[model samples]
Target: MPSIRLLVLACVIPLALGFKELKHVSYTQLPTSISSAGAELFQGIEKGTADAAAYDWVNHVLYVVGRTSHLMHVIDLTDPANPVRLFIHQFTRGEGFPNDIDICGGEIAVALSANREVNEGHVRFYHTYTRGSGATDVVLDGYVTVGPYPKSIRYTDDCQSVIVANEGIPGKDEFNTFVNPEGSVTIIHNERTGNPAVQTVDFRKYNTDDAAAWPYRVPSKYIPIRPTVAEGTEPEDVVVSSDGRTAWVTLLENDAIAEISITAQGLGLVNNAVRLPRKDWASKKVDTSDQDGGTHRRMYAGLKSLRQPGKIARLRIDNKDFLITADQGGVTSFTNAKHGFTWTDATTGKSLAANIDNPELKANANDVGYLGRLQVSSLEGKLFDGKNAELVMFGGRGISIWDSKNFVSPMFDSEGSIEEYTDSFFHDIFNCDYIASTATTKSPDTNKDTTSYRQGDFVSGLDVADDNGTVYMVVGMYGTGSLILYEVDTSAKVPIPMFQNIVRTGGVEDTWSTLYTNKKLGDLHISDLGIITSDQSPVDRPLLWVVGAGSGSVSIYNITESLPVIPGR
Candidate 1:
């Protein structure tokens, strides 16, 4: 489980006592050594965009939570870029807008759902303190009801336990159509609860293995009824395992990663699945250019890509266990895209629905299993090998590593290096609103779609997180409104990174989000991440916080520690 080789000096190291050493380079792409301490230092709650953050190292107070209004803002970071908001927690009537929040010891926990309804979800809990109380009377000391869309929340450094990720999407109707549900994870022991002790878990026997009727059948005429292979599967992110009873969850539309243990005879699934990996895109390394022009976004070799990992981070390294994905690639609304399926161009073996104008793939087509959206563990004749057997698209824009024993082993993958480090640091305008999403932005005459667009630095990454508590940063959350940072692994031997910053917290200039802009501030597509550690952070280190559903704003980044200058030193 240790082979990865990309060579640029590769490996060599000797002369320790006489002092020659130096060789762990790391940085597969765009990172031009600029950490004038990585500027910005702090950018408080611009009114809304802050999705899930937590801190209170005793009373420094930070607890954010608001991706789209519904409120819960308590800043006062002792003053980091003018933070002092101090109070505002009116979720008013059974939660739903808050996406994630967590704080241990004094206890906080948030996570709500029902934005669309299927499990109607919930997870509230509070009590950060009340001895001297009064900030408008803070309430809700317990609430439990989870399943539908509960996004993220955690606590396990002995806070007694609490976790939630219940993504289970699939709730649509009113003629919009959709309903998958099955994704789960919701524990809450709270020292043996008397009134707050739920435990959901579910995975539908791990998605039935593989049923068939031409893609999970749903009024299928040719495929495209959206076969999520059943048990619906969705669950987005949850970490927890420094021995805290194990929990991993991250089933981003099933690229896979599941575990969930919580013992003493409670929770379940020690390995619901593991999967992950698909960036073969012929091996150009990756840049999945979808907007023609940026020179067709690289990824060479034989081409085929897929690395849809979103939000999942866990670390330990020397005691073994590791993981850090955020390949951020997702999409699914399937309900007859005009029913296409029945092609079979297994890379030219022929019959792409008679190749009329190309488009017959019937939703990804799981490696020839028909009905597809990625899950190819084998097959090559009908091409499924590294996926992209031909056409290409689907996340992995960068940030990966796993081997929590075997979450599909093999580590380090930031190939094409974060779109060549966002083409040397975003001057703005890249991925121009995601251009038809892949296969080199099209133009082979597949009818009218022409070509020549722009935005191609390749960001699809959705979420990933890390924080050793005091300082060991590793985050990647980018649906384009950036947040990249890396550098963790001082020892324990493997986890070598070197790009210290890529900040863009709020997606400016390319526009596309409006998210309850009551106070106005939007564009940080991030999804989730919240870090803390500080007497001041920066050179004192640790302070990451990101929040981006509608991007109302809350983008703090400061993880400096770059120093590398050895060559003839």
Candidate 2:
């Protein structure tokens, strides 16, 4: 509704107000001052950077999660002039690797990557604290294990419960090949000082292998034969409403999203004894027989199951009135009051026809869409845009958005086309182990055969600045030992990253990652490695902070002040 003004500053204010008075400075690349210092931080990381976490509760102590160290490296930012490593703690799990993470009320939860070799997955919780020596660290709190592998942990507003998306297998070897029951999602209720309350939710009632063929012809092998509920479904991401009363979990293995009721569980210190499910819970499962042949995991014959990039994603509320789902092919919006859930063309922005009894989301071929065009408005934030709610998602490949708004006939009808919409653009990429707003590393072409869909490095973690709606996405590119910064403006028409910075030690060409490169430019992607900053701030102007993960240092730059720092300066 309002226009964003980009302000640039000339003189640096006193160190105290420097972060506050700095104005937004636009640029194609990151500032040299910040980039140079960033690269130096990763000198000792052998395996490479895995994730990053920032503590704004106090000053700005940032924690870099790494695969090489297999530990969290803490950097103190009280001075902003110098960021020093405060602490490092290492730990390993059997089945899952550490991926995304979330921190609230002093507790931290990280998405555990599944190790197919072990067949177990889970999310680890910790009780974090600051030591008297000014070193910040975390003490491992009890963790909760779940189906196969949990890919992400999305926390409710109150941080009382966490919704985890279980991907079922470690992406390294087994990927989509494992034939277990569709992986299920779980809500872990965190008690203030005790272990978490875990609820295993199985919405895998529908299987893909039971579909019938037509026209006297056999079903094509290429068609996705849905796996059976007995085989498990994959749920990727869990999103919560602002009120923290509901959670929408996305099932990636099956094309569906589950609305779970959190209000029934209540907020604050949670009571662990509640079962919370009603009788209709059995009906929540959808039939995926058409997608998967009559037999689950049988279509692959002797080979392992390959993953098909499905066209379904959602942003909705649990046990609430609305849900918005977008498939790579189309978008679907459903209202709790009537019409069940309806499908739509994300590109064309029109509602499609659906038969709820035998629900097959039929979108006109002409209307098929991608993740870039869809968004959802909901009552799920500390701040609301009047009737225009939080646009829960900035479009991405195979991602979902969960908004708590009441569903109208056609989803987002009153919001107008996304092109005309004015909100800060948000760009999020999930790679490495964490989910970062920016893509950090470039995957090797040799590895493309196995990780074809993954063009870049992995994301280690992410966090949103509740005060200003700025999303801090951390991508840990293990291959190149770099961290990339991508910013999403909540008020932009489309997500456009204003800047990108690379974080690594020394020149990327001299790094060990370069020694293993098969082709040239493999290490060039991270030539400018380091920490990152964004312009979206509830504060007068926000200074994006970047701390080097490997070198154990920090870099701070006011996004507003560096716009005119001049190229090559």
The lDDT leader among the candidates is: 1
In candidate 1, position 342 carries an lDDT of 33
Q: What is the TM-score of each predicted model, taking all chains together?
A: 0.31, 0.48
Q: What lDDT tens digits, residue by residue, belong to model 1 across residues 303-395?
A: 344465667777675577677776665534333431132322112212221322224442323222221222222222124233233443445
Q: What is the per-residue lDDT of model 2 for residues 534-567, given as tens digits with 9 covering 90 to 100? A: 3223234445443333332233444432222211
C-alpha lDDT score of every prediction, in listed order: 0.50, 0.35
* Prediction-by-prediction clash tally: 21, 70
Cα RMSD, each candidate:
22.1, 15.7
How close to the true structure is residue 149 of candidate 1, measured as C-alpha lDDT?
78
Candidate 2 TM-score to native = 0.48
